[model samples]
Target: MIIVYHNPRCRKSRETLDLVQQSGETFEIIEYLKTPLDTSGLKALLNKLKMEPAALVRTGEALWKEKYRGKDLTDGQILAAMEAHPILMERPVVVKGDRAILGRPPEKVLELL
Candidate 1:
């Protein structure tokens, strides 16, 4: 089963979800903004993403620039920031079995399928 961490307000996230639906594959959607991930959950997702915490952050977000910019923080601290502010988390992370991808271009999800 494929699982997509989605944010409906995000265009890329919506596009990724649309692509998954068009693929005609059964999948699960996690509306992460409404149901925020805790630190452990976020950490597990990072492991699935095969990336560090910073990699899963939307560094361009204003919250990131104002609050976290130039701050030397530990992995745990960064994860905590994402948990507290869901907007800091990158959108449309799709996972299939042990493999996952950040659907930045939306088409990247095709790799997992």
Candidate 2:
């Protein structure tokens, strides 16, 4: 099954959702902001994305800049931070089977479909 970690307030996330809907393929939407992922879940998502935990973070977010920027954090620490503050996570992460992509350009989500 396909799944997308979405934030309705984010334009890119909304666009990604629209693209998924337009594809006519059924997918689960995870409103990550309201229901933040746990550390294990974030780790699993990183594994699915085939990326380091840092790669999945929105480093520009004020929370990240204020609390985590330039900090020597391990992968586990970063994942923990994201679990504690979902806003630090990047948007529109689309997952299908064992693969996932960070839908930054929104078009990147097509790779999974």
lDDT of 1: 0.93
Error of 1 at 68 (Å): 0.7
Residue pairs in candidate 2 whose N, alpha carbon or C atoms collide under 3 angstroms:
none
Q: Who wins the lDDT comparison?
A: 1
Residue-pair clashes per candidate, as listed?
0, 0
**The best candidate in terms of TM-score:** 2
CA RMSD per model (angstroms):
0.9, 0.8
Per-candidate TM-scores read: 0.96, 0.97
| Candidate 1 regions with alpha-carbon error over 4 angstroms | none
Candidate 1 C-alpha lDDT tens digits along 1-113: 99999998999999999999999999999999899899998988888889999999999999999999999999999999999999899998999898889999999999988
lDDT of 1 at 85: 98
